[model samples]
Target: MAEEKKEFWRWTESNWKSPDINWNDAKYMTVGIDVGSVSSQAVIMADGKVMAYGNMRTGSDSPNSARNALKFALEAIGDMPEDRMDYCIGTGYGRVNVPFADRSITEIACHARGANFIYGPQVRTVLDVGGQDIKAIQCDEKGKVTNFLMNDKCAAGTGRGMEVFSDLLGVPIQEVGDRSFEFKGEEPAAVSSTCVVYAKSEATGLLRKGWTKEEVLAAYCKAMAERIYSLVERVGVKAEFAVTGGMAKNRGVMDRVMPFVGLERMKTEWDTQIAGAAGAALFGFALCKKGKGRKK
Candidate 1:
């Protein structure tokens, strides 16, 4: 029998709602949808506090992904009516395509704001590595964007980039970070290319040359760190740094990247991947409070 093809990078999809919230008592109910190239997220906030959220793998249809994400979020909270939401804001690559969003915001701004909310007022810099791109953002005390830069030119070092490696190694994506560190030998040198296709080829060559899977993973993780560091350096990093987006879960890349940045990362209890949607929901809440969204 042919070897079973393994999907190593498949992360969990989940929906959650805060038990403390009472929908009937929520003064302001807002929603945020983030539809990206590789994932989609929905966040529901009640009176500026997170009430519920859902995350899913994005499909080819942006609108469908947005709706599905929202459905998942509302499903956990008794499936509220859309008209009940005071405002809806959309972010990420497909922000403009959200059919129900009252407004759209840039991912850069949303990420900055979300990072501030998650890490508190101390966060001055954010590093977000997503499916199709990586972003380095600077923000003020109030979560306003001061400076930001993105690397969307290619997929290397992003979520999709790492996914390629995981699949190639027949390792689940969630395990990549830990497995990379399991190698007892000296860490291998970083991969040479920042292009996903080229890096994949390079990885193949290394495997052919007797490099163990763990060694390859370590090398790939180091390369991803180096790529992210270069982007952060160009944006002028500062103290109180925080990382958001799916890649934030990867300790292998983060451990290497932290040394290059020369600063301790600010900690947050919130799910890093939900930062963009959370920020968008906060923006919607602000808009609703200002009487700029749905009329009463």
Candidate 2:
């Protein structure tokens, strides 16, 4: 048999719930669905605390993606509490398409709130690297967005860029960070960060010139970091910088970007990708408490 091909762009995903929460006893129940260009998430909150969540790759159909995310979350908790939900909020690129959402909020607001929830009230800044865009947000103590900047014109420094590089190097997406560090000697020059096409061409040339895959990886990662640094500069980096979205998991990129931007990474045990959905759920919880839910 021919050697099996390696897939470098696939990322890890999961569904989880807090084991400590008693779903039946909660006074209020809310849900948040975040449907982005490349992924979708459903978050279940009971009385403002995260009870469960489901995340998956986005498919061609937005409504189905939203429904499937909720289905996965409900299955994880062994319950069908759809009727019990007091409010449901939708957010992200496909927010409006969420069939059951009572309201829609922007991903910037959701991400700010989610970061504040995970990193605490002290979080004042967020960098979200989504599949098709990159966002740098500044928020207040209450997780309200005060200012933000985004780069969506190209895929050079976003998750898609990382995926492209991983596929080219034949390394798993999760391992791209570690593989980048394997390169010894002087750090390679940064590649073009203006466009993924140019960067890909540069990588190919580097490989043809006897550069190791690790060296090419280092150059690509550095370029991505630098590109993001430029975008974040427009928003003005405040302390307590928290990174969210799919790219936060890439330490290879974060390791280079954090230093380039001059800030310490906010540590968190929660899944970074769920910030937007979790924030939307928190908003739903707040709205429910205010008796503003459409269900009411």
Candidate 3:
């Protein structure tokens, strides 16, 4: 039999519910759905506290992705009925496609709000390196966005760009971070091209010139770091910097970018990928408190 091809770009999917929180006793039950380009997340909050969440790969149909994400979260709370949810807010690239949402908020605002909740009130700067774009946001203690800049025109420095490299190198997405640090000697110069297609060509040339896979990976990560740093610079870095989205988990990029940005990332126990959805849930909760709920 021919050797099976491994999917190097695939990432893990998961769902979780808080064991300590009893949704039945909560005064408000809110839901947030974030259907992004590469992934979809659904978060359930009870009285402003996260009760359950699900993260999964986005499928071809965005509406189905949103529903599937919500179904995954509901699995953790077996008895929770969808109709019992007081409010549901949608946010992300496919926000308008969330059929069940009462309102749609921009991912930029949601990310800032979610970062404030995850990293605490002190978080001032949020850098979200997502699949198709990079967002650098400045916010106040309450999670309200003060200023922000986003780079959506290109895949450079984004998760999708990294996935292309992962496939090109035949390296599993999860291993890219550790393997990137395995290169011998000094770090190689970053790949020169900001365009993914040109960068792939540049990498191919480097490999032909005797560069190891590890070295090439390191160089690509370095390039990603520099590109991300440039985006963050436009919004102005602040103390208590926080990173959200999938890229925050990759030490390859985070390790290289932190020193350049000159700040320690704020710590959070929650999954970084759920930030946008979590923020949406929190927004729903606030609206519920103000007598705003799902439209009849």
Candidate 4:
């Protein structure tokens, strides 16, 4: 918790790598700011190294969240020469509200760009399961978004859903994976409800039925798995996949996704988090490579 919180404050690495920015070729490095529904993130690429990067919680103010996320990145750079900053790119729901951003991009493009950059050129698909949204994107070899799909209208199978379930079982979000891992027998919870509000109601019933916490968690995993597969299936279920965003941190979901997709085509590495941040940082490098400039 403390380490995650520190990202919002600034760069703290004792040993920082120099980004491979050609001083003669370009000016300032590029910045990527992702202001998500529940959290905000920033990344800076200078020279050949990721100069500074950080993420902070997004409170009620979306605009400030975007600005603060960028500021946090600067803090991480720890006296990084300000003159080197050449361009700024913003994304996520709050992108349009980031006053300091030179240009705002759609979250879909941002996620796709971010994912392709982190996972490498061969990444064919990305399951960006965010806090309040679910975005599935396909990308080309150059890290450009090809075809994508998203769902933001509801709250089923998202980070928010997990938080609610965590509270119902009296478990912290961090403890869910370990607790679920401890169970011996299979006891699934009844989560027939899709809407978040209704899911809460159903979770309460499962609690009343004396379902062990692990069983309930497992059931919830499959339930969310159901929703996630719907999106993955839409992208036509391809190989070389990646999953990004905050919820990508959930071990249970990570444990469940590849099996549902099948190990033969899945290629193993499914459970992940912060792939979005990695992607954002990679895009920052891209913009720098292109000698990009932006205003307004």
**Model 4 over residues 1-296: C-alpha lDDT tens digits?**
45442122221122222354333454447777777887777777654245556677776888888677767767655666655677777788777877777777787877776666666667778888887888888888776777888999887888777877776777777767567666675546437876678777877778688877787777787778788878888876566877787666667876777777774323323223335544555565666667665532
lDDT of each: 0.90, 0.90, 0.94, 0.68
Which should have the higher TM-score, number 2 or number 4? 2
Candidate 3 lDDT, 1-296, residue by residue in tens: 99998889999999999999998899999999999999999999999999999999999999999999999999988889888899999999999999999999999999999999999999999999998999999999999999999889888999988888999999999899999999889999999986789999999999999999999999999999999999999999999899999999899999999998898898878899999999999999999888887655
Compute the lDDT of residue 195 as modeled in candidate 1: 81
Compute the lDDT of residue 245 as modeled in candidate 4.
72
Output the better candidate (2/4) by lDDT.
Answer: 2
| Candidate achieving the largest TM-score | 3
Write the number of the candidate with greater lDDT, choosing between 1 and 3: 3
* TM-score head-to-head 2 vs 3, winner: 3
Provide the TM-score for each candidate, comma-separated.
0.97, 0.96, 0.98, 0.83
Return the clash pairs for model 1, or none: 8-171, 8-172, 8-173, 9-173
Per-residue CA lDDT of model 2 for 100-121, tens digit only, reads 8999999989999999998899
Candidate no. 2 TM-score: 0.96
lDDT of 2: 0.90
Rank by lDDT, highest first: 3, 1, 2, 4
Report, for all candidates in order, the number of backbone clashes.
4, 0, 0, 12
Instruction: Show the lowest summed lDDT stretch of 10 residues, model 4.
Output: 6-15
Can you rank all candidates by TM-score, best first? 3, 1, 2, 4
What are the runs in model 3 whose C-alpha is more than 4 Å off? none
